[model samples]
Each structure stands twice: as C-alpha cells, then as structure tokens.
Target: MPPVPTDATTSTLANSPAASLATSQGSRLAQRLQDLGPLLGLILLCIAGWVLNPDFATAANVLNVLTRTAFIGIIAVGMTFVIIAGGIDLSVGSMAALIAGAMILLMNAIGTAIESAYLVVTLGIVFALLLGALFGLAHGLLITKGRIEPFIVTLGTLGIFRAYLTYFANGGAITLDNAVSDVYSPVYYGSLLGLPIPIWVFLLTALIGGLVLNRTRYGRYVQAIGSNEQVARYAAVEVDRIKMLTYVVLGICVGIATVLYVPRLGSASPTTGLLWELEAIASVIVGGTALKGGEGRISGTVIGAILLSVISNILNLTSIISVYLNAAVQGIVIIIVAFLQRSRR
Candidate 1:
C-alpha cells in the first residue's frame, strides 16, 4: 500500500500549480455561464411563449412586442451605464412623465405661433432633449458636488418630478395638440424597411451605446470608477465627471424614449410611465450587470430588456397570470437576480 498522506502533503497538493490552474478554469467557466445566462433565458422564454400560444411567433405579433419594448429598451441602455458606474436613478419614470407633459404643453403653445407642424414638432424635440440634459445635470451636481448618495437624490427627485407634472396638469392628463399629434405619430407608428421607427431607434441606440461602452476611454473610466472609486481616483481617473456623464447619458435616453412614447398615447398623466424605474432597473440587473457595479455589458442589457418584454408579451398572450401582475413579475425577477448575485459573490 502507498504511504498515507500527511497533513503537510495534503496542504501542498492544495497549493500546487495544478490546483491554481483548476481554480482559474472553474472561475472562467462560471463567468461565461453568468454572461450567457440572460440570452439563454430569453431563448427559453421565447420557446415557452411559442408553446403556449402559436400566435406568439407571428411576424405581426413579434413586431408589435418589439415596438412596445422600444421605450423601456432605450432607457435600459442608459441604465446599464449608470449601474456599471455604480449609480442608480429612480426618477426616470417620473422624469419621462414630466418631460412628456412639458413637451405637449410646449408644442401646443408653439402651434399657435407657428403654422408649420413640422417646425413645432422640431422645437418640441429640442426642448425635450435640453430639459432632459438639464435635469440630469442637476442630479449629477447634487450627487457629486453636494456629496449625496445617488439613491436618496433620485428618490427625492422621483417624487418632485411627478408632483410637478401633476400640479401642471392639475391632477389630470395633458393631451397633445391633434395636429401636432398627427405629425408626430409617424415617429412611433411609421415603419422603415418593414420595421417600426421606434424599433429602428432602439437598435441604433443600442448600437451606439455598445460602441461607447466597449470602444471608448469614457467606458473604461466608468467601469474603473464602479470597480473602485478611490482606486480609480488614485489611478488619475476623473471619477466624479465620469459618474456625472453616466447620469447624463441616462437622462438623454429617457428623453429619447419619451419622444417615442408620447406619440403612441398622445398624452401624459400621473399614470404615464408608471413603475418604469422598476422595469429599467430590473432589465439592467437581469442582463448580468453587477448590482454593486464594477462590471456589465450593453449587449446583456439589450437582451435583458427584450427578455422582460417577451415575458410580458407571453403573459398577455397566454394569461398565464393576471396582466395586472406584470409589475409583480418584474419585482420578483429583480429579487431573484439580486439573490443570485449575492450567491455568486
């Protein structure tokens, strides 16, 4: 018989190069699985959807689902940057409502001064983008300059934004001018190469967002800051500025999504964009982004957004559960994903 191994021999084996290599390989494999998790989930969900309702696979149904997804998908792209940079913004839904209300009011007011519906629409779009940037800048300044926590800041603004919109509307809906609505409807309803304009916009936004996150210096800085803010600063990164820009990017995305959304409903109310913050945040986490920040991918976010939309579509098509419980499902997804993140850690 071979000599019984001693404690020292066992310890030596554990510390050997082969053991290290094995550990490294295991880690890499786990990481790849985590990265593919969202995509795989999406495929499985689609299969289930098809099985539940053969109508789910039709071209019209698929396009309709995607068109509906554009608003949240666009916003989720920006949320990806914010989460990767170790920040959160709960005010996005309320911000969109306020922006939509303001856009309608502005367009209505301007229609009287300008006979050109196109010119009025152009002004409304510009106003929406500028206002979004301004709001984002305010959030950044308060967080960076005022040295406040992002959660607290955005939470306060969430209430404030919605309250302002409510007050402006006098607790009612703000409807778009009919003529302007007709002109702007195409932004949401029109199709290009057999795809909805909103879908096209979503694709373009994702493409640009992916490029910015993967191929640019700013993206690296955002990741470094999220990984370790103090270490990033020590490494000569402008941590505050990068963090600020991430919020600005998110705000711009909110603006773009709102521009697309307003035309669909032709109105903004207290109910407008309800629980969108939940959906947006859920999408980012589901896409494999770390809740604690430091690591993420835009592609994952895009898939996550699509996956959530698909889930909602499936539910609607199959009545697997009440349509009213859609938000509940998303909340559950966030909780599950968060738990998984903690377990992985």
Candidate 2:
C-alpha cells in the first residue's frame, strides 16, 4: 500500500516490538532463576534441618544461629569484595585475633588512667578500626605497588599477626578490663526489640556492602578489574587503587567484627579467631561468587553465611555427629558446591 514494502522492511516488521519484548522477557527470566538459586538452596537446607530435628525450627534456636552467623557473615562481606576484585585475604583470622588482643591490651593499659569506662571503650574502638584500616592499607600497597601475589602476602601477614597476638597475650588470654567489660557486655548480649544486637550489626553491614558493590562507581571498577585487568587498564581504570581499596574495605569489616566479638567473650587469645578465614572464604564461595573472581552477590553471601551456621547448629544439636567433625562437614559442602558450579559452567 505504501509504495510496496521491501523485503527488508517486511523482515524488520516481523522481528520488531513483540519479538524484542519476548526476547527481553526470556533474558530476565533466566537472570531471575540464576539469582534465585542460592536462596532456594538455603530453603532446602532449612527444610532438611526440620526433618532431622523438630527443635531445629524453634525461634530460640533459629535466633541463636542467626546471631552466631553474624560474625562470619560480617567478615564474608569484606571477603566478597576482595574476591570479586580478583584477590584473596588469608589473614583475616589472625588479623581478627591481633585486633582483639591489641584492643584489649590498649584498653587495659589505659583503664587505670581513665575512670570513664565509656571513654576507654571508645578509644579501644577507634584504635581497632584504625589498626585494621592501616594493616589493610599496608597489605594493599604490597600487593599493588610491590607487585606481590595476594596469597603469598596475606599468608606472610597471617603468621606475623598471629605471632603478635601470641606475644601480646604471652601465650594466654588477654581479658578486657572488668569495669569496661561490665559496661560493654550488653553490646553483644543485648537485644533490639526481639532480635539480638549482633543480627542488627550483620544486617547493617550487609546493607552497606550491597550498596557499595551495586550502586557505586568503585564497584564497577572492582568487577572490571576482576573480569580482565588488562581490559580495565586499557579503559583508564586505576586498577591498583581499586584493588587496594578493596582490602581496606575488608579490614574495616574485620574491625567491626572485632568490636562486636570483644563484648561477647571480653577476651582475646591466639585462638580467638583460629580457622575463621576458611569459614569466611567458604561462605563467599557458597554464595555463588566465582572463585576465579569478576562476579558475586552480597545477598547470596548473607544467605550462604546463614546456611553454614545452620549446618553447624544442626551438627551441634545432633549427638550422633562428633563435634570435631564440623570442619570435615564444611569441607565436604564446599567441595560439593564447587563441583556443582563447575558443572553449571
């Protein structure tokens, strides 16, 4: 009618609007399923727990597990950032112990001079945060500027940090000042409405972490670096700066965790955070983050953290499973998840 449509025009019309919409819908559906995988796995795990023990569904038990999960969950948030940026931190466990021991020592050293328990605690908090950030910065510099492998650098630092803790405590526990402990105990054991305070801390950490990774330009750089460092460098992204900052973020997360942890036990020993680095790394991987880097989801990480905690809780609740086998169980789960991911690829 309109001067006779050409063959190309007909073909364009055939593929326009409706076809495009259908394709877009299909893509979104695929993405939705991908995002739903971890959550679905978590639900299945919870169901299995209920089947294994009726008490697994109890509110008290559930809350207890969530509260305990907060510690590893917080650290894993930082681990997510580091891993997504194509790096790893093998020293978090030792770093946590170092921070805790150093903080307790600092507080006790000043406890006699400062009558204000609040002031002493505040100073301890500041010191812990600063130390964590500084240590992170140092690690970043060595990795970025000094051109060292993250694994090697963090491993060296891990031993150094744990040794410092041992020396600080003199092979014993560094207990917090009793007066300060009395004032700070509520921070960990206290409740906000019906939920534990630790849960609130975990929620806050996760929220900020998600925003940073999803909504910030820095996050884009992180993903870019991990995906292909050469491509990112060609695009004028500051690869070194972004990678270093990721470690800083990790350190701050560790600091926040130490703050919450100190209030619970009111002490720090060489073994305070022993073997925690593995748990944090495992949590990140279980959340569907690629071990090779370049992609991750924060919400999935929180779910993964919860899933691990639930398994540990279940194992504890069941006498049939030896408590010593907890680590073995975790290793098996990690292996299974890795195999599934490989198969999916």
Candidate 3:
C-alpha cells in the first residue's frame, strides 16, 4: 500500500494553483481503445494460432482451450477487483489448494462417518467457499487495520498457506474419498445446456463482477480509492473497508475455482494452483487495468484469460517451442502487454 497523505499534504496540493494535472484527461475515445486492448490481443492470438496450425482453430480444440481457461479465468475476475482497488494477493493459488484440500478431507470424513448422507458434497462446497472468505478476511484485516503492505502481507500468507497444504497432504496428494468422487465428479466435467459447468461458472462470475465494477457506487469507491488514496479519504470514502472487501471477493472467487478444480482431478495436490497469482495478475493487467490501480474492464479480463489459454494451447500443439518455453512466452507476452498499456497512457 502507498502512503496515505496527511491533511496538510492534501491541503498543500489542493492550494497549489500551479500544480500540474497528473491524471488522464477524460476522453471517451481513449477509454474505448483501452477497453479494447484485451479483445484485440485475443483476436491477434487466435489469428496467429490459426495461421500456425489449422487445428488450433478447430471446434474441439477451442472447447478444450475454453475448458483450460475456466480455472484461471474465474480467479482473474476476482483479481481484477483487487488490482483495480490497488491491492495484490499472492496467496490465492496456495489459498485455493488449502481450501480445496480441507474441503476434500472434510467430505471424505463425512462420507465415512455418515454413509447415508448425500449432502456431504454440497456441504463441502459451501465449506470451501466459507474458508476462502475467511482467509480473505484475515488478509484484509491484517492489511487494512494493521496497515501492512498488501504485497508483504499476501506473500507471507502465500507461504503459510502453501506450507499448511503441504503438511495436510503429507507432501503427497490428497485424493477424494472413492464414495464421494463419483458423486462430485460431475460438477467439473458435467455440462448444462450443452456447455461445460466451469464455463458457466466463469461466465456467471464475470457477469456479476462486471456489474459490480461498472454499475455500483461501491465500484466507484473502489476506483476512487485505488486511483488516489488521499483524494479518496478527502472524499469520505471508506478506503480500508472497500479494499478489505476486494480481498474477500477474491477469496470467494478462488473458492469457486477450487470447487470446480477438485472434481476434474479427483484429488488435491500441493502443486495445485501454483503460481496462479502471477497468471491472474497478468490477465488483469492485459485486460487494461493499470498496475497503479483505479481502472478495470471485466470483459477485457475474460478475454485476456482466454488469450492466455489460447497461447498455451497453441504452444502445446506445435514444436516451435519446447513445453518448458511456454512460461517464458507467457512472461514475454505479459511484458509486452504491460508496455502497450503504459504507452497508451
């Protein structure tokens, strides 16, 4: 978190008639172009994939790409809020693993303890979401009330969560109970109205996120808080409260992603959600949200997530680069997009 200026500093800046404007001049055309950045990137990636390998554009491959996109895409939605509100969460990936592992362990115990209970799976899902929210709340409180930097706070929690997961899994995999596996598998692989469930979940999350960010007073507060903390304080915005809620929202999103994630693998491994924070951040940045905060486009974030999946999918289908090089490509792409975003500003 940046330093919150004092009243004197605020008054000094305000009274300076010669103070130069540092903010973007409101321009609808420029804002539209910025909003289109991720979509344009997605289009270019698709075109490249098609030109490189015709199979990349096939329906089956596209569906596969979307399936892969669902996990990170969902997480990125929450990340948009955190970043737009001027915060970061490094613990999300580890937090997801921790939440998923706990939920699985609970469900398995429930299955063994109560053979007749079919609601265990549902209970586990709720439990995971609740756990995620709690984790977020903890992070939020420590950062807001404690006045700790988000990067430092979330980084510490990231390691703590990862360590707990490792201990919970005994440094191995935590498999879902056989009895519950059959019952829970459909949540990940099953489809509704000819669409995979994860896709539907991502779409719903993005829709709600978009509405909250674009249409609500809370959303405006978020932007204000992120753009300029001092100004936000002067305007009577509850900076800490809004910032704390962003993390809570992020936690819920991670929990939802993990719920869908667990059924697909039928197990929780320590490796699950590794480095997901970096990917989610990349998606949000590519989506046109400034690293300095105060702006976001939910639709662009979704497109950015899909763009990442497409890039990976394309790399997997070709020999142009080794599989190990995929991460390198992603890093380079993120850097390039960041530069583009900076140039636009």
Where's the lowest-lDDT run of ten residues in candidate 3? 15-24
Alpha-carbon runs more than 4 Å astray in model 3: 1-27, 343-345
- Total clashes for model 1: 0
lDDT of 3 at 275: 88
For candidate 2, write residues 164-227 as lDDT tens digits.
9999899999999789999888879999999999999999999999988866767766876776
Q: Rank the candidates by lDDT, best first.
A: 1, 2, 3
- lDDT, candidate 1, equals 0.85
> Which regions of candidate 2 fall more than 4 Å away from where they truly are?
1-31, 322-325, 337-344
List clash counts for every candidate, in order. Answer: 0, 0, 0
**lDDT scores in order:** 0.85, 0.84, 0.82
lDDT for each residue of candidate 1 in 1-345, tens digit (9 for 90 to 100): 224443243223334232243246556676667678777777877888999999999999999989988999999999999998889999999999999999999999999899999999999999998888888889998999899999999999999999999999999999998999999999999999999999999999999998887667687677767767776787777888999999899999999999999999899999999989988888888887877786688888888888888877887888777878877975675455444433155
Which candidate ranks first by TM-score, i.e. highest? 3
Provide the lowest-lDDT 10-residue window in model 2.
10-19
Instruction: Write down the RMSD of candidate 1 (Cα, Å).
Output: 8.8
Could you give candidate 3's per-residue lDDT for residues 1-345 as a string of tens digits?
224443234333333221122232555456566567667777877898899899988877887788778889999999999998889999889999999899999998888877654688889999999999999999999999999999999999999998998999999999997779888988888988878888899999999999888667677677767767787877777889999999999999999999999999888888999989988888887887777776677888898888778878888888888777888987777666555555244
Candidate 1 minimal-lDDT segment of 10 residues: 10-19
Model 2 TM-score? 0.89
